[model samples]
Target: MELDRSGRVLAALSVAPALAMAGWLMAGLPLLLLGRFAPLPMLLLGVPAAALLCWAGTRQAGKVVEATVWQVAGVVAVAAASAVFNGVMHSEQLIVRRDPATYAQYAAWIAGHGGLPISVQPEAFGGADPWLLFEGVGFYGVDGGVAPQFMPGAPMMFALGHWLGVPFAVPAVLGGLAVLTVAGVVARLAGARWAVLAALTFAVSMPILYTSRTTFSEIPSLILLFGGLALAHDALGRPGWGRGLLAGLVFGLAVLVRVDGLRDVLPVLAFAGLLIAMRRSSRSTGSARPYGALGLPLAAGLVAGAGLGMLAAYLLARPYLSYLSSSVRPLLFICGGVLLLTLAGTAAAPMLSRIRLPRWAPAVGAGLVVLLMAALYVRPWLQTVTRDPVTPEDRRTFAMIESIQRANGMPADGRLLYFENSLHWVIWYVGLPVVVLATIAAAVLVRRLLRDGTPFDWLLPLAVIGWTTVTTLLRPEITPDHPWAARRLVPIVIPGLILLAAYALSRLRTRRWWVTAAAVLVVLVPPAVTSIGTAFTPVERGEAAAVEAMCAELPPDASVLVVERVTGDRFTQLVRGMCDRPAAEVKRAGAETAPEAEVRRLIERVRAAGRVPVVLAAAPGQVAPYGPATHVIALVTRQDERSLVDAPNGTWGLGIDVWMAVAR
Candidate 1:
């Protein structure tokens, strides 16, 4: 009985990874499939898929727990870290007013008026609107036009939020949770020590923590990308028909999450094919059974995933077909490449089996995969190569990068609820190719791990380093060594940290445990302090208070214009609710200023609109000439840096300080 129980446990352990992969894929696959057929198919497919996943996951939990404590701990830690990061840093107000809200309202405006489409033609060439979140409409800058450049993922998430709640912060918080799920899942795959490191890296290394609380879909898409990879790995390692089916489901689901995620899925399928090839080659004599067993299930899975994804795309596109020309073409290119690669990989398998192959064969096979990845990287790479004029978006992004590039740049203004524009710079500078490279490297590492050396894997670290390197290269802001800004490197930070921590624990050297403990303390402190500070203080309060103070100082009848930083969502709520403010409030104000000298003209217009108009500037130094001011009030001030706040305002406030200026 004892021996039988042990054997059963071992058998279950061997199949666990595949089972997990299949379960997740099964859960997400139907939604993707349903999407392809019709939106209503979601009810037909999702209920079944979700039920299977839950059942499979629950059944496996006991066996997984029995296999290793590290797995449990890693999963819990990654999830906990993500939760802690967002829980501490995220807030309701921050979520609703973050950058995306500006776009959300614009989308809503379009939806309200016959679902107008927005165009996204940048004056500068090589500008990125790569994802096409709003290809249904165009994002024509801040005009709230019909055509916005945003992708469907973000708008869909926002739309869901609008249907469900007020504040819209709930979606942002949920976005953070999605990020947490990715971190947790990745950490678990990396192992316990690495998992903790991954969590730390995610928490502090990259902008994942920051995005957790924002309405942005990038991080959520990234999480889905990782999920696809993990599930594929699980399926490949298990070698079961059901698992392969699940992998297909996951591959389809990934495409549904974000278009970029599809890039990561390619290498996973290639790796799976490699496994299938290996299994085929290992069989003695050409046997039909082996070929059928390996190829049929995999082919079925491929069809399911691809078919489902295509179905979803068509269904989603049905409502708005005209705007999809540019968007749909890229997917076609991807599909064509996938088909060509699959054929090539299949054709080359027999040749790869030969011991004394043609001299150019290895180079050719290797070169093909490399070229495919190179092609994918090219567009994003070129975008980074070109630089644009530094506007408000540019400066804000630069400051974010500088925070990471410079050690002391973490602004003391507030800890939590601050948006990092630098992350975009990092991603662009870094290139989207790293996602592909990391997935490939991780797959290779997993293969090596199963073959058995020390059971240590390099996938996690490769992912982190590759992402960080790409991010650092593309970003105009941030040097390589910025400490607080180090969050940009979160992809690899946790994995790298885990290696160090693991090494410390395993080392027989004197006081090694102390070193590990100290490392944990160091990693835990920054986030802990950030969380504490964020909980007690509001990140938006400085700007919010400034806006409130500026409003209070103005007369009820006066026309006040905020001639700074153009327009964005941060000021949206205030402007929209202006009519609802108290009796002492001024008539509704507006935000004005061009990215260039036209801002001065706009300020002049405000001065002309009323007698002794109160023009409050926040980032005054960014603008020039301070233009003739009767009474200028500086609601916020930064260091002696060139910005809108530094323009020679007659009165200024420090912290909560108030100052008054007499009309000239």
Candidate 2:
């Protein structure tokens, strides 16, 4: 088979992101196994490995696929342009926001030591280290030491960038690749015209812009998720175990990047099951099957690969699990069960396919099962939100939100559903009209998929959109501040909606050029403008400087105590990681004032241990009681104005004052 210029460009676009993501995942595995994740070695080893995989996947297609040199150049040019744009929009300094700061610390540790740290310094406050409880800082205090409480995926990617002297590079690059991946998928599913439109739409969506530029895990997760979907789609189309194994491998990596990815990928699992079933049923005809000789192996490989990948992730995250007071045994059982069930289903496919059923039987059965499962998962969450008192987790999140509402002078005790529009939050960032059109497109696609048989092409997208949208809407946790909550939708909603919109536009059948152009502009322009404008806006300035200055003034042997006042202390990780200081938060939960006696005791203990003690407070008054003997230095941090919209004003990086008492 031969390909046109656009087709060839689309192919290249697909190939590059897949290669990049595969390289990233492959590079981390060896380092992880060796207990040392060095960036230079990963890059050196990963590049060749990725190239070989790409070459092997494409070598057998037996097609003279060629695009104009200009076309290939355009793909590279666009990817580069998007990367630069994202990088410019990213955080200006080392992030000090709670989660980002935590991930940054993980990245820093990985980059510096080439492995997970044994323990972070103990909290300076009265309780056992806050990190142990996954409080105050983004760490879990374990057995007198602290470890990061996040999955290793994003941090591993960040560590790679840290080695290259730019910690933000990984996400920025992945963000650009995500855009290309969207375009590539659209091109394959629709056409090149629509692919361009899809790429442009994704590139400028606010959710994409925001998540890609931050240390948020969503960007890397989306890259792997989308890349895996694209590859899996290709494997399904062509009968080959290699492609299937590769797709499964990529999907597994996505799970490693974020545990929630297991939920995100359920549709892929179902789709693989369907494919195996179809292949089994067709085998009786003695006809050519699309999956060729290795059809059964290919299907089995995807399931096995994903299972192993998730198991690997669970193993790597044992420290985090210990901190959460959870065990790996349950996760192991789950993984083993999934693998067993999948293998059993595949083995039984031949027997099952022989049994006659109505055409709609599978769809109806699957829908009912999913509905039942969702109900089971959501029942307790709904009760907590409505009938039951707020749980501790919800209370903490509510406290944070209430603090923000107070700072912004918004009403307290608003309706429970005040932020319940989580389902529709995309409309705020991408604009309402675009959302309406995307909805229409999605509806149209669903109708077609149901009316016609569920082709493999449509099955994955439909499942992803349906499952993700449902879960996102029913998300039981207190809706985090607006745009940030939208981060959860980035790996699914933005891309899914963009693809649907592109499909809608492609089906327009109108020959009028002006009409097509107008339609495209209406769907694409507003969100693009909003996102691009936000990208150019600077945020979080002076934060790095403040942390640096504070660190510089502290004695080398000083231990730091962060007193959580109005802001509720999330800066311990920043001090611990950025300032290279042992830091802890003074527990002031629901307290009217600082625990002066406890604070003094901790200070005395630090002194007795031959370390100077410093107290850092978000509000100056928190340290006021220390009085004449106390020396205070003011530190200022500027926050991203955008973050305050959903979060407390003080949640973002803020200016703080550090105080220390002199022994007289």
Q: Which model scores highest in TM-score?
A: 2
497-520 in candidate 1: lDDT tens per residue? Answer: 333333333332445677657655
lDDT (tens digit, per residue) of candidate 2 on 407-525: 66777542243434553466555665566566666655655565555454766777777677666656623345645566777887778767777777777777798977887688788
What are the lDDT figures for the candidates, one per model?
A: 0.39, 0.62
Clashes of each: 51, 8
**lDDT (Cα, 0-100) at 636 in candidate 2:** 55
Collision count of model 2:
8
Lowest summed lDDT over 10 consecutive residues: which window, candidate 2? 642-651
Clashing residue pairs in candidate 2 are: 120-146, 124-584, 131-140, 131-141, 132-141, 239-291, 404-648, 637-655
